[model samples]
Target: MTQPLAELDDVRARLDADLDEVTEPLAASALAEASDLAREYGRDWVDADRCPRLVRGLVARATARFVRNPDGYARSRSGDESVEWAEGAAGDGGVFYTEPEIRLIRSLAGRSDIHSVEVIAWGTRQTDRTGYIPVEDGKPFPYFADESEPW
Candidate 1:
């Protein structure tokens, strides 16, 4: 029920073709599917109205790929001849954004695969403990010495 990110004209423009009745419907469905996917993946970070151009581009690219290969076949062979489909084309021939496109969306949405956190230990002094020894170095005057003592 949500609005499509791209229009039929956008898909047609990407395809560089004046879509016929049959292809038009297929393209329209593709646009809807692609738009929904973009909205779902970018719900956290993107305001659709604010970045219509990028969303539209993603929808168009995904829709075009789907319309071109609805069967989602990976390879076709005929008497020793074979045709290999493009990367996304082999997977259900469905509307899908490429890796780079997903990365762009994630970047726009302020998400990243790499993450970091500050680890803190309770009841311990907030100081750098790297290369520090309690008993041998005799630097601390808190807690039990046996905990830090070597066995």
Candidate 2:
């Protein structure tokens, strides 16, 4: 079922507050505009409760586009603290992520509402997390067998 448009006001308001947390002046306004864009686009594709998430994704996507150093915006937040990478022992080459993994992390990190960023290894049976995002195959965003080996 679809949600009514009036409810978007509250979501947008919350998004405005979230956008305020952004330090860059230009990025702040850009993120606000991105939220509006998400609202317009999501009215047809997403429900009310999911609108905030969609807006957050929109902000992430938009921020990924305008920023000079994309890595700077990829800090994932947990409670009051921000974590740049998920806590885990180092993988192959002692590198935490590959090029594609870095892009995915940065993309997901753009959202201000996320509490943490966790990359579940592809074959793992775990499914307790609520916001699991699947990775697409190939080139720019290749899925790795583990953090160390690209598939």
Candidate 3:
């Protein structure tokens, strides 16, 4: 099932809150628009409870997967707290992806590019924490945090 058009407003609300936390005035509204789209289409693919978590997981997994580093340090020039947190949480053998990046994944739900296979690929990487996320592939996305990034 896909998310109803009404839920898009809620998604926008949440994204706005997140962006406000980061003081990113520009991306805040833009991401909120994307969030609206995510909330809309998410209904067609997953149930209500599953939709938000899926978005969070997809966003998390996307950051974890594509942003790998040989030294395990995701050198983000943006310096967003969310990105830094993911990096701080990772191990030397792991890669770090940002929360917003994962949020993008959440927004991708029910789209042609969004698929279980891609989500799995992102989630399967190992992390330092146990309950940071549900199991992905044979493992969970490694979640580590040295210090809380100031939002």
Candidate 4:
């Protein structure tokens, strides 16, 4: 069953509070462990959990608060439906950052000066089989081009 809006907000707040305490740079070994743990946690909620939370966690851990790109693969192929931070994963608490984004923050934070970062992502391209329902005319997810203008 779907939860009410307020219930979802509370979960997000809790997750935010949990993440704020990380300060000192985690060692590569530690980062690896953390990444593994993240993957496990995300996998538990496959239907509407793993990938979305993975993305949001990237944003949550970042120092530079960039705006989220409001686009991603959905459960089905044909729907134009999108997910915001709040109602993504089953227990996600509304996060919308990606693994690359998190690594970007750790790099900028000079985390390497102390210890390497430990990152464990939930999903990857090498073996993604999330049962994406095909969209209209049997089209797959749209190709996303990052912003780059010819100067």
lDDT top scorer: 1
lDDT of 3 by residue, 1-151 (tens): 3332223233344442342443343333333333344454444434445555556444333232323232344444555643422335354433233556434543555345545653546546654454656655544445335334221
Q: Which 10 consecutive residues of model 3 have the lowest summed lDDT?
A: 61-70
- In the range 1-151, model 4's lDDT, one tens digit per residue, is 3211122222334333332233212222222333343334333222333335433344233211211111222333347764434344312422233555545544533343476687756333343325555676553443124324111
As a TM-score, model 1 comes out at 0.63
- Give the worst 10-residue stretch by lDDT in candidate 2: 89-98
Better of 3 and 4 by lDDT: 3
| Candidate with better TM-score, 1 vs 3 | 1
How high is the lDDT of residue 8 in model 1?
78
Candidate 1 ranges with C-alpha deviation above 4 Å: 44-48, 74-89, 115-151
Reference-based TM-score, model 3: 0.22
What is the lDDT ranking, best to worst?
A: 1, 2, 3, 4
Q: Residue by residue across 6-119, what tens digits does model 2's lDDT show? A: 232333443433323443554554455444544443333344354445345444555434433334344556798864632342211121233443454345435333587787
